[model samples]
Target chain A: MTLPRRGPWRIVFVAALVVAAVIFVIPFVWLVSASLREPGYVFSTGLLPLPFHPENYREAFQAVPLPLWLFNSAVVGTAAAVSVTLSSAWVAFGFAYFRFPGRDLLFGLVLATMMLPFAVTMIPTYLIWSELKLTDTQVPLWAGNLFGSAFYIFLLRQFLLSLPRELFEAARVDGASYPALFWRVAFPLIRPALLVVLVFEFKASWTDLVKPLIYLRDESLFTLPRGLKVVLDRFGVRRRAGLAHRARGQRHRHDPDDHRVLPRPAPLHRRHRDHGPQGLSRARSGPCGRRGRWPSGSPRPAPPWSSGSGP
Target chain B: MAAPRRRPTLARREARWGVLFLAPWLVGFLVFYAGPMVASLWLSFTDYDIVNPPRFVGLDNYRQMLADPMVARSLRNTVYYTVLHVPLTMAISLGLALLLNRVGRLSGFFRTVFYLPVMTPAVAVGILFLLLLNTQDGLVNGFLGWFGIDGPSWTTDPAWVMPGIVLMSLWSLGSTVVIYLAALQNVPRELHEAATVDGAGSWQRFRSVTLPMISGALFFTLIVNTIAALQMFTEVYTMFFGNQSTQQRFDADASTFYVIYLFQQAFQFLHMGFASALAWLLFLVILVITVVQLRLSKRWVYYESEES
Candidate 1:
């Protein structure tokens, strides 16, 4: 019974690996093939033998101002990542080093905050930004995440906790000040975790859609996901209208300028939503009345995400 | 070198410096995290449309949640995802980690290759899958055809949608494999050697020694994986709703994950109270599962301290 295994198990393991590779690769292969397939051929293309179309990417490019959106995403993602990392790491140092009153309680609350739904804060946070007059700017888009972000703080604290307390004791026995000790001792030890946090923050912020959508009303400020949304929504309406017009067959009878059927997205090619004066026509940035506030000004009276009476 | 601080002022200054170090995190938690959490609990008791002022509604949100059919469906979907994904991840990661533990070549490179998926932006992954799983031009069905087994339209069919989510999850099991590999390296060679002397095969040694030795790591992974699965938002958000075309989907109900459903109710429909209730219930579910796992782990998880 066992002799068979020496031969078959090796074959079996190889077969299993082959099966696993198929599982991982098949879906991804299909996606690249589909994304490259043109919209016209999209419906008709059979799976394996279909001709590869590089033009679908061109169509996708034509469909959206992907370059600008990509740029905006990079900026926003990087800003959030850097800000969150520095703040979180600095804050985590405090939690890790100090024996403060309410530290445990505060840490518990931070962990508990991880459970808080974004919806509960959505209105209040929006209202705060509105009140502060920062609604349309990239300032609001960057929306400096505080140092005490529970998740990152906890992560850094855990890393710090794993360090030998004797190291801290040894530093204190010497001439090192607390700040110098943290900077000199703790920071070096937790470099790995800090690097992880930066990557995590970048990925989280870059892929995020809802935050930018709420805070940044300016078309120039749209992140990749928001920019992507505008394209998808606009193109969808256009495709629908275009389809209808095609169905009607060259009817010059319809009002040519009527935009009710065709939805035009903000022209992504320009820094402004549209270079044509019609696009920049100032609109109320919604009920968020005081929308011009930036951090470059005095410390804003209200929290960035809260409409609560100013602190 | 220097001496200990001579003055009371210096000791006091050191204490103050420590406080200053912690102050940023402290202020952020109280203002952003704690404030919102308490606000959410309060909002759970009120009828909030977000735009309109919230009104006191007592337990109406919780009552409505009890009556909500979608809550049950979402809960079922979540439990199914957690149950299926956790064991599958464990099995796959362990298998891969074991295979690579004694590998002859490029161990570090293979480890990095596995972890690449975990680092990928989840939305990009979703988009990537969307392209691949396109019913018509998708590569999956093309391979299926080779096997003489036709796969269903993965995203289109309700039966296949959750499976798609699960498969997407399994592909990212590299993180778990890395952790498992780290644990595997520490398995006492003495135990494997002792078992080897007793005529034990690789399978027997793994069962009696490796499994028991790594039970703590297994426990930790289970709780973390459960929490990750329960809080799964980005994948479902991108896959089903966030990146959804405005076109009507095949099974509208099937597309929503439990967490995503809660997000929609609160954000899209402005049912903040109901959403809070859903969040609170999820918190309880996670807490209960965590407690149960911890209790069970006491029996099987051997602390190194115990043997010492």
Candidate 2:
């Protein structure tokens, strides 16, 4: 029997959905408004900008090497995604198509690796990269991925396992080589899973800040996330006077501003004014107050626990 | 006898092909994952500062963690995030999925709209929230102003920092919603129809019928979401402590997640040994929680194949 489709239920459902939809878009709408906002007026409460200044995008490009950062992100992300997709597909092909001794046990190990936390391996990996002289370059960012990630392998294998065994057997009976079958038949059939791997890796590489932070030291090599972090730190709402300096730099100089947003080499008034009288006094005291300490002058205090080189 | 003879040789040939095809992952597994994992365990006992050779210091780092204030603080913050984030995300995602399922014709369009936020990079989302949650001029606070309510200083105020993160985490609920929607679609319509005939109201029918059918997906999302929430890092890192300025420290207590603290120990302070210990500790915690979740799931999670 057909149930009543029209009633209070329909109205309530529509109303609830409309509210949820608006909530989902609020941050996005604000991002657009803030990005288009006037240079100094970076924060905007409205959903839409009143006096839309699209020039902030231009200023942002000039302020940091936006195009270079995007290019770096693309190169790293694309390389990692491409490598991961190819390698994982190759590995998955073997697991799906073969019935070898210890295959199940080996595949189990692969699955186990997915749960292995980055924290456990990050330090040693960094050390290995440093030893190889791969640190401070983009090599560390995508090098590990050239082998393949466990999740992608597992995902592709599951997809491969679901396919009819007859297809592979037929190809093998025709005297097709394993690699030839993988390229001609398996690869085309598993396009969707491959796309998922590619998209996931690309997004991951694009958004990653920690890897770049741990590895890349030079400004020229920074990806978009790292570059954005630099921008936010230098020019967030708390630091109003920073925009003033940028504004001045735009007017006075033909060359790019030499100021790197570091602790000013000299404690100039511009730096002190932002921190106020109390901050200036702390800066004078040499130790710099704990709340406002910059790592530049004050060497990081050794943790109390580090005194254990053995008695 | 002839079939058995051919089988052995064919199996041998296939195994060889498998090994050849698997070479890339085999090399990767050895170099990237397995080697580093073993090295990490060893390094956890030695004090290494890339500049100098590691000096052996057995249990010192682990012992020190027992007294580290930041360790306690970050753990508390991480647990707090996981506890709130997982359930809230699950509820919101399921709710959105239910709503979208009801709005059957527009599911495709609405699904894209909802999923867009998940596609945006986490860094961009974090940066956007930094603006949206600004105390004075943020859209969130602005909207609050409409009701004559003053919003909390979200990122700046320690009290509101976790809530701010929780709010930001909700923006990416689109992925989870899509998963739940897929599960909902797979729920047999005949069951719902049967429930309706039995005089069960919509809500009643949902509670009794739909819930049990999609319990497997529900359980999967819950465990995955919980694991992710425990490892919350990138958004909080970019939003709060990622200072490129000479002063790398930002004293936002509520925002100091466990992974972030571990990262600071490893990279910022060069405490490689101590950080490895922290990493192992985190892994142990995750392993235990996952095991507990699996044990608990036996009572509630429904498997269709097991029914017969």
DockQ of each: 0.18, 0.45
Model 1 pairs whose backbones collide: A30-B132, A30-B139, A31-B131, A31-B132, A125-A305, A133-A290, A133-A291, A133-A292, A133-A293, A148-B25
10 residues in a row with least lDDT, candidate 2 chain B? B242-251
Task: Pull out the clashing pairs in model 2.
Answer: none
**Could you say which candidate leads in lDDT?**
2
Alpha carbon deviation, residue B49, candidate 1 (Å): 1.5
| CA lDDT of every candidate | 0.63, 0.75
Q: What DockQ score does model 1 reach against the true complex?
A: 0.18
TM-score of each: 0.77, 0.88
Best DockQ among the predictions, by candidate number? 2
lDDT of 2 by residue, A6-82 (tens): 67886777678888888887767656665565545544345566456677666666667888999999999999899
Candidate 2 at residue A38, lDDT?
59
| Model 1 chain B lowest lDDT segment of ten | B241-250
Q: Quick one: best TM-score, which candidate?
A: 2
RMSD (Å) of each candidate, 1 decimal: 9.2, 6.5
For residues B147-182, write the lDDT of model 1, one tens digit per residue.
987777687777887887887788889889888888
